[model samples]
Target: MRTGGKRTASVFLLLTVLLLLLFYCNLALGTRFFSPAKLFSLLSQGRGNDPAVSILFKIRLPRALMALFLGGALAVSGFLLQTYFANPIAGPFVLGVSSGARLAVALCMMLFMAQNRALSSFALVFAAFLGSLVSLGILLAVSQRVRQMAGLLVAGIMIGYICSAATDFLLSFAADSEIVSLHSWSQGSFSGMSLAQVRTAAVLIGISAFALLFLAKPLAAVQLGESYAESLGVNVRRMRSALIILASLLAATVTAFAGPVSFVGVASPFLIQSLLKSNKPLLVLPASFLGGAVFCLASDLIARTAFQPTELALSTVTSFFGAPIVLWLLVKRRGK
Candidate 1:
């Protein structure tokens, strides 16, 4: 195999191994540890009256699967945004898309709670999707006037700040009861995930990923330049719109389920691209998905276990690893 191809294969193999290992770790090692053989035996019995079975099926399994799917969704969303913006660091979180979704979900939850009604999974997803669109809309408007990519990034950061501040303000007026519920979600976590919710997220992310795979050719073309893409018969406007919607959908689905995860989006794609030594969309897209799953599983494992009974928020672990990667990318790009 060619050097780049060999590198790609090696990296992908490594990511897959890590993903499986971490998936096992997330399930087998928790407040109560389960050995691999025991976990397998529990699974074979199917839902039973045993407490260990309940923990395995109802809790650990669902949480692990959610992290696997949602983590991939976040990374794919980030990859799509980076392609659209032609900026390596561009991602849903950095661009305020996730924040927008978070704000919407928070608002929806608060309203539903006030009415003494609970939001269905689908309703939360819809609300998050709407918020993501709104954030992207604002970012697009800023892009129109801000000629420089750096300026547009700065604007995105400001928009994120504004949305976050709005969320906090809303929280201040919320009931203590509401605060207790929202506080846990707002901090970001994979805890409390259910099998039904996992199905919802998996279906949504599955569809988005399917669409993304088909868009790879045009995405690569657009990455080179709009003019080149146009020459290749790619409708730049339609492609741009599709990219925005897909990115938003992926980000929204994740936020709807896991609150707002940090850094997986930005860090995963960069690491994947660097490892593969290529920017080819088809190659990077799937690899980024796997890389993201591994990253999140590792981070989540650390977050829960690092403090024993006291668990850290998901973002706390992600930012700890993700921030330095972002900083390195910034400094490396600035020199070029």
Candidate 2:
């Protein structure tokens, strides 16, 4: 095998190892620690009214799996946005997509709570997807006027602020009961994940991720430039649309489930590309998915365990680490 292929293979192997290790840690090191052998025995045995089994299957296991799937979805979404915008820093969060999704989900939740009705998972995802498209549309319009990538980024940030403010305004009118749920979701979290929710997220994310993988070759060509891709018989417009829809869908699913996790979208792809030393979509796509899983698993672990019974919001931990990496990227880009 070629040296580059070998390196990519090695990186994937390392990321897989890290992903497994973090997944294990997430399951093992919660408020109650479980040993590896005990965890295995519990997993292999019947539940039969065992609290530990319940904790493992119902609580810790679902949470860990949610992080794995949704984190990967968020990262892949970010990579798609970055590729589409031809900007390394462009992401669902930075581009206001997550905020848009958050706003929509918040509205959906508020409406349902006002009616004393439950919001279905499908409805939640649809609201978020619609919100993401709205945000993406606004950014696309702004991008036309603001030619500079920096200006577009600032505009995206401003859009995010506007959505967040609107969400806050909505929150002010929410009943106390509503606020408890909305407040937790608005802050971003991976808690309270059920097997059902995990199944929904897994199905949505898995399909979207597979679609993106299928388009990896064409997306690579698109990244080279639209005209170039078109010259190669790729329908650049259709490809771009697919990119937008798929990216939005992935971002929306994450927001619907996890309340708009920050930084994983931007940081994971950048880290993967840097580590892989290549920007080819075929290589970066899968690696970024795995990298994102590892990133969120590790972050989720820290968020819950760092305070010991006082869990921090997932976004807080992500931003703490991700923000520095973004700043460093900006500085490095400026130097270049």
Candidate 3:
């Protein structure tokens, strides 16, 4: 067991270094590869009349940073949801939170577009948050009646389909130009993120991440069951409330910026737990966050370069990878 623990710690260290390298790779290697040294020089100095430098700053950096923050947020949200529900498969995407957020954001976008008003970034996030809460409310109500985990999951999926249908119906009535924009976003591409949006996300996600970490102990206690958690002096109700709000905010932020990414939330925690061979919350949370960052960064890289001129949506690449992991998990659980 000690040897296995050492190996997992080593893996975490390796992943951290790999994540840093991926950051640079995402910045420098694209359709046109910039030398690492050149990137350093560009950053060290300023973008003094160089169009490439502008592309580097105005495009790649923000996207990579978005992938980092939103990806980590999505995974942590999944961890919280899974912990709360005591189900391995429970997550923002699987529970319809992402789709709910997407529907809300889509409606907001259509309204803004119809009025010829530009939608602010924070407005999109707020809309998504409200949508996430609505979906969460429905899921919680369903949970009270659903006796089995399968029934709960089925209900969640139904909610997702309903939201997706609503989003599609709304888009059908939107202007052609606006539809084009909304369609790309709804499909989940991490392109076109700006520095200002990144700053906002960083600040918000940062505070939330810290709050989550602070609750790690309570979260772990809750995993055993509400009665057990309360016996240990953890306020089960408040803990659950925090979990729902934090998970919703995290999910909403991702949907707001990157659209509805599939499966990362459901997959990252499993992958991280497998690597660590432990379910301790303190260890799992950070490892899960890093795993998520790596997954999204790699997925984003493939999305941009895999099809050359035709960049795929971020979710396409993630779904290609994440879906299989989810399937494998289901099969493994069934076998167990």
Candidate 4:
């Protein structure tokens, strides 16, 4: 047991080091070059006329931070959902929460763009939150009486399909310009994130992540079944409600800020579980967060620098990496 614990600790340490290295690489590389020392100097002092510093500090920095927090939030949210549902494939997007947010944002953008009124980023984010909450409410209602996890999962999928259909209808009927804006938002980009946007994402994700930490034990207990958890003094109903809310909040916040980034939530927890060889939420949640941040940061680096002059869509980049991982997980589990 001691040897196993030591090996786990060693692996975690290695992952931590790798994550830090990726984060530094995110800060160091961009469209314009900025060495580590120079970037540090500019951040500590001020960039007067150096466009590299401006790009690094103003553009790349915030975007990278946003990606980190948003990715971590999504992964942790996925972890909670998988734990709650006892399904390895469960994730935030699977529940239609992200689609709900996308639907709301599409409407908000269509309304404002049509009227030539400026829509605050915060307002768009709030609309997404509202949409996610509505979907979450429906899921909670169904889950309360459904009893069967498979039935609840089916209901979530139906809700997602409904939201997707609505979003498509809106796009089909909207003006060309509004459609363009909505399309870009849905495709998901980390570009153009201001510091204020980063701060908002940080606060929301931080709060939700902290709340989830408190539920780690209960969530683990939940895996044995609700009645089993209740026998151990866990309040199954309250625990589920809190977990759902936290997962929704994390998913909504990330979707609102980063435009429904694909697959990190689904990928990260599964990856961590594979690495750890255990289903313990206590270990899984934090590892998922770190793994998510590392994945996003590394992907963002490739998206920005892979083509050098032109930037790639963040979602496309993630999908390139995430889809295969998801498929492999499914296949591997099927084999087991």
Best by lDDT: 2
TM-score of 3: 0.97
Question: Worst 10-residue stretch by lDDT in candidate 3?
Answer: 44-53
In model 4, the number of clashes is: 0
What does each candidate score in C-alpha RMSD?
A: 0.9, 0.9, 1.2, 2.5
How many Å off is the CA of 156 in candidate 1? 0.5
Report the lDDT tens digits of candidate 3 across residue range 1-336: 889779777978988997998898899988878898889988887668888788889999999999998889999999999988888899999999999999999999999888999998889999999999999999999999997998999999999999999999999998889988999899998898999999989987988888987899988888777889899999888888999999999999999999999999999999888888888888888888898989999899889987888899888889999999999999999999
Q: Candidate 2, 116: how far from true, in Å?
A: 0.7
Which lDDT tens digits does candidate 4 get at residues 1-336? Answer: 888677668758977997888877888876556687887788887657877767777887898888788888889988888877778777877777888988888888888888999877668778888898898788878988998766886788899889989988989998887777677677787778888888888888878777877888888888878889999999998998788778878888888777877778898888888888877887888888888888888888898899978878888998899989888977987799
Q: Model 3 off-target regions past 4 Å?
A: 1-5
Per-residue lDDT of model 1, residues 1-336, tens digit only: 588778888998999999999999998998898998998999899877899998988888999998899999899999989988989899989999999999999999999999999899989999999999999999999888998999999999899899999999999999999999898889889999999999999889989988987899998999889999999999999999999999999999999989999889999999999888888999999999999999888998998898989999999999999999999999999999
Any runs in candidate 2 off by more than 4 Å, and if so which? none
lDDT of each: 0.92, 0.93, 0.91, 0.82
Model 2: per-residue Cα lDDT over 91-145, one tens digit each: 9999999999999999989999999999999899999999999999999999999
What TM-score would every model get versus the actual structure? 0.98, 0.98, 0.97, 0.90
The whole-model C-alpha lDDT of candidate 3 against the native structure comes to 0.91
